[model samples]
Target: MENIAKVCSRLIFLSVICLFFAQAIIADKPDFKYSFGCLDKGDYTSNSTYKANLNHLLSTLTSNTEIDYGFYNSSYGRDPDKVYAIGLCRGDVKPDECRSCLYNTTNFLIQHCPNQKEAMRQDEYCILRYSFCNIFGIMDDDPVYTQHNVNDQSGNLDTYNQDLRTLLDGLRNQAAAGGSLRKLAEAKSTGINNKTQYTLVQCTPDLSQTDCSDCLLSAFGQIPLCCDGKIGAVIFTPSCNFRYEEHTFFGPVADVAPPSTNTSVADIAPPSINTSAAKGNDGNKSQTVIIVGSIIAFVVVVVLIIISCIYLRVRKPREKSESKLINWFIVKKV
Candidate 1:
């Protein structure tokens, strides 16, 4: 149980960090393109047919876009049609990270669950799940985790809850109304505690608006489990997910306007620092300084070694001559 807890903490830790860091980039920065995926793993018996079919289905799920996904046929020889699976990457993750994550999750799920037909793996940038039953189009929020920071409530929890409700409702509307390829909603509001809380609510494009709202609503309730009085938390389910925190978690949206990095004022740096790209010889000079400093230090060490050897050679002979003079003086005194 302790090991499992540790594993859960470590595995789920990245999802939390990603949510926090997403806000690190200035909104003015260009947004990058990405893809997403989802799956429902239903329970199944040990011996079952469709084993070959399951393998084929998984193989047919060719990886694509910024999101790469695959289903590994688990049964080595036995045909178990009883197995079902799905893999979804974040809409903003790079294709390379998505691919590596998919590959890792596939291998991990097999090792962690063994022959079990029902299992799920939620990661920092993607999700992987498999079961025997068909779960598409259905909304599931139960058995999910909603977590937040641990701090004293500034005012009443109810007031903050109401604020969250109003803001999330607007975000929900906006996200559900997203395009066919992506569905995401994020907004911020000032709570009674004089703190700014940002909430991000989203779902896989495959799910209906009803499913998305229902999932977000249900996840809202689970926030007490992992994040009761904290600043933020993430409640993720098989199909939909939501997160709320005081800090920004998602990076600025990538510029969709064709190979452009700078286009608008909002693409400028954040309030804290200047984020412009380094230019010309100044940056190059700094790099050269580092290299030149290292080489000079090496040469100085070699020169010091030669000087020390020369001093030692000269000093050793002088010391020997003094010793012989002392012996002659001792003999004359006798």
Candidate 2:
């Protein structure tokens, strides 16, 4: 009986230790999804010289190209005659992530849409869109595609969307003011109902004021397809993208100031940034859990000690009595 009790206690202890480590791992991780956008139309100008010019322009620029430290751009540089394109990255991604994503997207744009010069790729982290026609600051609803979460988290639609919009808009304002070197913004909002949300918005630096705002608004409208009725979602295009979720997927806001609007890709550029150079939002959930858990752990330890002392204090006399009884019975039998 004593051996069985000891085995049961050992199992219980192991189970509790496993549970604690599992909780810690679950508390610190983030959920990130990926996506891309493509524009299907591109008719190179009929003039041979113009086509050559266009190809040279394209060879020089990629659909989504990393220009400076943390900023990204889309080059209509494909056709110098009619320059129009778009590039964007998330506000929280580090400069290296921004660069790496852009570099990979350059290949993606060329590979996925090789024959079609107008194609674009919209991934979870960045977007690359270019066209023969002027697409800046103008709304293009023709190729708009909305994607939402495959699984529904809850049916609390109204409150979720409202909180998402407010948080996103605030993030937008912050991104717009990011200036010449960097333009990105991220914010978190907790609803009155205690549901928490994280939002991130970003634009390419080359875009004009009106163009930046309009492109973001256009992407925002596509949320119904991406994030509506879900715990998290990302809406993006080659020009701009917005995302919000119950988790903090974004890394960190750069301490670097905004780049100048007119700062061209040329001249004194920003330094190459490392991915770890910036931090992630990490959400408030973990912090709250850790604090509460600490208090609970402390309380549990105190209670366990008290209970153990009480058991020992009570068992000592009883054990002595039991030993005496056993000895007395033995004497009687003898």
Please tell me which predicted candidate would have the highest lDDT against the true structure. Answer: 2
> Model 1 lDDT vs. the true structure?
0.54
Q: Per-residue lDDT for 103 in model 1?
A: 66
lDDT of 2: 0.58
TM-score of each: 0.55, 0.59
lDDT to native, each model:
0.54, 0.58
RMSD of each: 16.2, 9.5
Worst 10 residues of 1 by lDDT: 265-274
Model 2 spans with C-alpha error above 4 angstroms: 1-33, 43-69, 74-85, 134-142, 150-156, 177-182, 224-226, 258-334
Worst 10 residues of 2 by lDDT: 266-275
Candidate number of the best TM-score: 2
Candidate 1 displacement at residue 95 in angstroms: 2.9
Q: What TM-score should be assigned to candidate 2?
A: 0.59
lDDT of 2 at 182: 54
**Candidate 1 local Cα displacement, residue 184, angstroms:** 1.6
> What tens digits encode model 1's per-residue C-alpha lDDT throughout 1-334?
3554455455446545643454332221222222222334433334545544444444433343322211111222233454445565554454455556666776676565655556677775666665666544456664574444444456788877677778878887777766433467766668776887767777765468777777777776676666666656666787777777665445433212121233321112111212221121233245446655755665565566556556666776799899999999999999
